[model samples]
Target: MPRLADIDEISSLVLFVASDDAGYSTGVEFVADGGNLLGPVPAAKS
Candidate 1:
């Protein structure tokens, strides 16, 4: 589960990037993960 802040941050970032304010922006990957990167993972079965 992702936190509200993560979603909001991504949403705002996207809007800003799409607007003229981010005209000078280049290739960038916005990762909105709320510290979940260090959490556990599920097993993938074949």
Candidate 2:
């Protein structure tokens, strides 16, 4: 997704972390950058 993420998308993650569902989760990262860390996509071959 090259475009910016929706508010609900990021909020959902935050909700999960705050909820008991994420009780066991620790020492981890929660990335919400829409694959930006993967770098730009390569151009398609001709």
User: Against the hidden reference, what TM-scores do the models get?
Assistant: 0.45, 0.87
Instruction: Report lDDT (Cα) of residue 18, candidate 1.
Output: 87
Worst ten in a row by lDDT for model 2: 19-28
Whole-model Cα lDDT of every candidate shown, in order: 0.74, 0.93
lDDT of candidate 2 over 4-38, digit per residue (tens): 99999999999999999998898779999999999
Off-target runs (Cα >4 Å) in candidate 1 are 1-7, 38-46
Per-residue alpha-carbon lDDT of candidate 1 for residues 1-46, written as tens digits (9 for 90 to 100): 5455756778898899889987777787656676687696667898
**Total backbone clashes of candidate 1, pairs 3 or more residues apart or in separate chains:** 0
Candidate 1 has its poorest 10 consecutive residues by lDDT at 1-10
Clash number by candidate, in order:
0, 0
- What TM-score number comes out for model 2? 0.87
